[model samples]
Each structure stands twice: as structure tokens, then as C-alpha cells.
Target: MYSWHTQDYLNLAANIQKRNFGALLLHGAANSGRSELTNELIQFALCQSPQDLHACGQCSSCILWREDNHPDIVLLAADNSEERKTLQIKVEQVREVIDFASKSRHLSACKIIHLPDAEQLNISSANALLKVLEEPAPDCIFILQANNINKLLATIKSRCFKYQLTYPAWDDALKLVVENNPDNAEFWLRYFNGEPLFTPPFENHELTQLKATLLKPGIDAIFALSKDLDPKRVGMASLLDFMLKWLSDLFLVKHGNNANYFVSDTSAMQGLAAKINNDKLFALQEDLVFLSRWSEHPLNHKLQFENILFKYQQIYV
Candidate 1:
């Protein structure tokens, strides 16, 4: 378990030991270690011999789980296929969960249904799952995970024992990052919004080039960068996320606040913020926000990206 999430793990473990919950919802920001905590809890719950509210690796249950052959655990997730472009958990999957929950455990005392992305459940699937939650089968535990509980149906959230794994303290997160990556630790920490576990070295060449262009923004550079943006390769959503963070930091610098995401580019941000028209910058930010909703759509990605870059360039005028 991550040091930052140790307390949350213990608290949830205590609850798990106290009594069996029909449904447990672990919600938090993306990459806040919710999945990790859920896995540990599943192991502990399924383990025939748990030591100190933790799974003992020597047990047959632990061995099966470690080998990814735990018959008692069912994972429900979005269909990630080339044909199925949408990121929704279909009702068919939920129906399977309902069927699985109705049966007895194959290897353990209880059965666990793990939905790692509960927020991806569409209306149909959510309603289907809600029925199962309402009348959960005996000895069946549903472990739901969501990045944003707000996106979930109110009824689903209400039925579960909710636990939030908040972003760790800045110092604790920074310490973990520094341990793994001594250099640029602070930059990565801010890049991932203080979630150190996901702050690996930023080695994506496309993003690297894009950042370099932003540091020295020019009409020619912006156009060149837009030309190289392949939606399938780097992803339009990823591009929008990077731009959102960059714009957020720029807005902060404009208002005399420190850079938030781009800590390493503070000097460049300050220089750009000083020259750009505040109103135009704010308008560009709004435009980005609007575009993010359609980033994953099969639109004219290159043209849209070029238009955004042109808008950013015009902010200097």
C-alpha cells in the first residue's frame, strides 16, 4: 500500500472486519490509489487466514489471487475495444454481475464484485446495477470505484459505504516523488496535481515537444506543433488536459499567483502572462473548457487543434 493511503486502508479494513457491507464505494480523484486500496481490501476479505487485517501471502486464497485466478472476485469494467468506441459500462456487463452475485462463492467464504470505474456506467447499466445493490445477494459484496462520485447516480452512492481517498499532502507526495525521481520531483508532483504515484518521468516525446513550443510560443511554432498532433497517437483528450493545465498555470501567473502545474516553466509563464491580453487569455481558457467535452469525438482534430493554437497566438496581440 502507498504510505499516503495507509490510514485509509486501515480505516476501511477496520470496517471490513467489523461487518460485511453489501456495497462499498471508494471514490477519489484520478490516480489517488483507489484501485490499489480496493485490491488490498479484496485480498483481505477473501483470504482464509488474514493476519492483522491484512492478507497473508502463504494462504491458498492469496496464492490464487496473486495468480489472478481468484474465482470469487468478479471485475466489471468498460468495454475497451476498437469497435466499441464509447467508454460506457454496458448493461450486459451489469447483467453478468447480477448473475454472478446470485451464485455461491467458488473458492472463498464470500464473493466480491469489483467495478473499478463505476462512473463509466451509463443510465441503463447504472439502473441495472442499482437493482442489484438494492437487493444484493447473500454473501455477495460489491466494491465500486469511481474517480468522481458526482457523476454517479444518487441512489447508487446512497446505498454504498463511501470512502474517499483524497490527494495526499504536498510534502508527503513530494517526498515520495523525490525518492523515485530526485530531479524534477517538484515539477512532476505539480503536473499530476500532488498525486506522486502517477508522476513518472514525463517521457512522452510529443508532449515534450509541445511543452518546448509553449515555452517559446510563436505563430510558426504553434502551427508546426499543431501539424504533428495525431489524435490516435497522443490522444486529443491528453492534448486538452495538457493545455488546460498550462492555461490554468498561465492564468494563475497573470493574477500574481504562482504557477500550479507547470512549475518548471514558471519564468516562461510569467513572461507570456505579462504580454498576453488578460481578457483574451480568459476567453481561450473558456474555449479549451468547451472543447474538452468534444476532445474524444471523431471530429477534424487537426483543424480544431490549429484553431485553438491560432487563438492562443492571437492573445499576444
Candidate 2:
């Protein structure tokens, strides 16, 4: 209700108003608007006087939300402010939600417990949350958000209403991205699959240049960007994903098939395909797949990523 995607908002609002569903799961690609929807739904559920599925900003509940002090709404999300070995929605966090559910609503009819990173809930924590879900708290609603629904446990997913919200078509999303950020339209469009907020910031010029370097890789493409490639500052996961796209495109073009990513870079892909063999391509793919799983926290991310680049260079040779 507060953002651009509203069709789901309307339907969800009505569902919330009609009766308590106890649990709901919003699944989609990374950077999809699942978090936004959960935020709106929190307000909608806690609002004393909602209008057509929107919160009344003037109500006490709405006022509390505006002040960032909603008692009935519990949001336990992954902590990303500081570097960690691995991030997760810890068991203690889910326990807090259970405790919150145990108490009466502070300002509304029911409690709204929202977990924005549902997939990050590991076994112990998920089981902790499941205990409450099985008991069925009185008038309590649980909201879960996941980037990939398949990663979630089937039993947990079955307890909640599942909604998949993937990104809109490129043309549709690019318009919004361009409207909000016009200066780096091309870079943003290509980088985020058209998801505006997911685009690397315009100020990250080094990464922008890295994109071009990957397209027309040279003998020292990795060394060229070594100074700016800080695993801490830049998202290594996304970098790996982008690299996979380029490699997959090159592989496809080599096999006389359509490219999966960077589809517009036909000539560049052709050049890359001509230089590399199928075996090398598959090797690169395996390396990327393995690195991506552990890229979140490598002992020496610099050396790890640099090695991938070196491997690519050797493949071309």
C-alpha cells in the first residue's frame, strides 16, 4: 500500500481484515518487493481503523508505527550492519516473537510477527518458531519472507500461505528505475535485472568499470580492478552471480544457442566463446558454483575471487 506494487497489497489487506490466517510466506527473487509488502501488512494488521487495506495514519497504532515503536509488531531480520562469519535469524530472535505472541496486543486486535529473511532461519530457530505456529496463538499473524522459496523447509512452508513475487519484466521495471535514477540508467538496468533499489549505487564507479571489464576481458582484467575489489565493501555474492551470467552466456553462444544473460553483448559473447573450450567453461561454472556458496564469508575473499579471475584468464589462453 505504501509502494508501487499494490495488487497483492489489496488482496492481502482484505485477507487480513476478513480473518486471521495465522501465517503467511512471501517468496520471490532477491531484491523483489517482499519486504515492502511485509512492512505495509504490518501496518495494516495493527491499524485500528484501516481503510480498504491501508492503515489510518492518524490512529494510535499508526502513530506508534510512524515513531518506530510498534509493540504488537515484531520484526526479526538478519543483521547486516557488521561483518559476521555467517548471518542468520538466530533462535533467540524467534523466541522473542513467541514471547511477543504470548502477550496481548499493545494497541491493536492481534499481534503481527514478521520475519523478513525467512530462508535465513536455520534448523533450531525454525523449529523454535514452528512450536508457536503449531500452537496457534490467539489472533496472531506471522509473516515470512524468502528470496527463494525452495530453500525453505516444506513443513514450515505448508503451515503458511505462500505467495511468489518475482521481478517484473525488464521493460516494466526499467521505466521505474529510470524515472527515479536517470543518470545511470544503463548501468542500473543491466546490473539489477531492472530492480531499482538492487542496482549498485551510482557512486560505485569502480564496480561500474568492472562490469565493462568483464564484458571485454583483457590479460589483466582482474589486476586492473584489484585496487577497488574489496569483498567487505562490495557484495561478493552479486559479483559471483554477475560473473556466472557472463560465463553462461559465453557457453551458450559457443554452442550456437541463445545467451542466458547479457543478451545484448552478442559480439562480446562471440569473442569470448571463440577463445574458450567447452571443458573450460564447465570448469569455470563449477568453480563459480562452489565459490558462491561460501563467498559470504571466505577466510581470504581477496585471494579467493582473484583466483577465479586467474582461472578465467587461463581458460582463454
Candidate 3:
């Protein structure tokens, strides 16, 4: 368990021991350890001999969890397929969950249905799941996890007992990051918006090059960066995310506020923000936001990236 979430986990465990909750919705920012906390709670609930609100490793239920074949736990997640072209939790998957919930627990006291990304539930699936939530089956607990609860249906959100796992204190989070990456701890911590538990990408050479190009953007540098970054290799979504954060910082700096994500590049951002045309920058930001939605599409990524870079360059003119 993450040190920051220790208190929340204990409180939730105490609640679980007191009375059964039909549904629990754990919503929080990405990398806030919501999934880990949910898994720990499930293990604790299923353990025949829980030790101080934690699962006893020697118990049969704990052994099953370790083996990755917990009979009473069902995981529902988005369908990730190349052909599907979208991440969605289909109605068929929810139907399976309904069926699972109706059945008896094979090994544990109660059956658990874990939906790691509840926001991925499409309209049809959400409706199907709603029926089960409306009339929850006995000895069944539904654990739903989402990064954004706004994407969920109001009816669905209303049914579950919501628990929000907020970002940890800056010092506490920084300490965790420093332990694993002492050299670039502060840099990475700021990069992820202070999310401490994220695993840093193995190679950030391309990102470093991109940052350099952005810092001193010109026609030649922009064109070079567009060609140098291969969407397949570096991930177009990642590139867009980096650019979005940088642009956000630039906007903040333009409005007489400090940089939020790229604190290390505040001086550079302030310099650029002073020279940028506000209207052009605003248009570019909107265009990038629209393009981000299609970053994963099978379109020509190189051309798209080049176009975005060209637009970005225009903001300075």
C-alpha cells in the first residue's frame, strides 16, 4: 500500500467490517493509487483471517489472490482491441458481471465485481450495470474505479458510495519520488503534476529533444522535431500530452501566473509568452485539444504532427 493512502485504507477497512456496502466508487486522479487501495480492500474483505484490517498472507483467500485466481473476484475493464478502434465496456461485459453477481461465492464470503475504469462504460453497458446496482445481489460487492466521475451516468454515480482519493501532500509525494529517482525526482514529480507513484519512462531522450526544440522553436527546429519523433515509437498521445501541458503553462504565464507543469521551464515560457500573439496562441491551443482526440487514430501521424508544429510556430509571428 502507498504510505499516503494508509489512513484512507484503514478507514475504509473499518467501514467494510462494520456493514456491507452494495457498491463503492473509488474516483481519483490517475496514479493516485486508487486501484491499489481497491485491491487491498478486496483482499482484506475476502481474507478469512484478516490481520488488523489487512489480509493475512497465510490465509487460503490470500493464497488464491497471490495465485491470481481469486474465484470470487471479477474484473471488468475496457475492451482493448486493434479492430475495435475504441476502448469501451460493452453491454456484453456488463451482462457477464450481472451473471457473476447472481452466483454464489466459490471460495470467499462474498463475490466482488471490480470495474477498474468505470468511465469506459458506454451507454448500453452502463444501463445494464445500473439494473444490477438498483437491485444489488446479496453477498455481492461492486467496486468501481474511475479517473473522472463526470463521465459516469448520474444514476450510476448516485447509487455507489463514493470515495475520492486526492493527491498527496507535495512533500510526502516528492519524498516517494526521490526514493526511486533521486537524480530526477523533482523534475519527474512536476512532470506528472505531482503524482508520485508513476513509473518514469525508460527513455526520455526524445522528450528532452522535443523540449529543447520547443524552448527555441523556429522553422527548422519545428520541422526537425516533427520528423524526428515517430508516433509509433514515441507514442503520439504522449507527445500531445507533453505539448498540452507546455501550452497550458504558457497560457498561465501569459496571464501573470506561474507555470504549473513545467516549473523548470518557467523562465523560457515567460519569455515566449511575452512575444506570442494571444489570439494565435488561443487558436493553437484549441486546435491541439481537438487533434488530441484523434492522436490514436490510424491517420497520417507524421503529417498531423508537422501541421501542429507549423501552427505552433505561427503563434510567435
Best by TM-score: 3
Candidate models: Cα lDDT each = 0.82, 0.75, 0.83
Candidate 2 residue spans exceeding 4 A from truth: 1-4, 79-83, 183-187, 201-221, 228-232
For all predicted structures, in order, the TM-scores are: 0.89, 0.88, 0.94
**What tens digits encode model 3's per-residue C-alpha lDDT throughout 33-52?**
77778889999888889888
For lDDT, the strongest prediction is 3
Residue 181 lDDT in model 1?
A: 79
Model 3 TM-score relative to the real fold: 0.94
Writing each residue's lDDT as its tens digit, candidate 2 over 200-300 gives: 54255765666667766665767766547766667778768777877877778888887754566766677777888678778989989988888866567
> What order do candidates take by TM-score, descending?
3, 1, 2
Candidate 1: what lDDT?
0.82
- Cα displacement (Å) at residue 291, model 3: 1.3
Q: Tell me the tens digit of each residue's lDDT in model 1 across 1-317.
A: 67778888888887877765789999885565667778899999899988898988888999999999999998999877754445888899898889889887787777899988888899999998999899888688888988879989999999999888867888987887788777767877777877777744335566577888877778788877887766556677777778888888888888889888776678877778888887888898898898888777788888888788888777875
Model 3: how far residue 314 lies from native, Å: 0.5
Q: Would you list the clashing residue pairs of candidate 1?
A: none
Model 2 lDDT, residue 135, Cα: 79
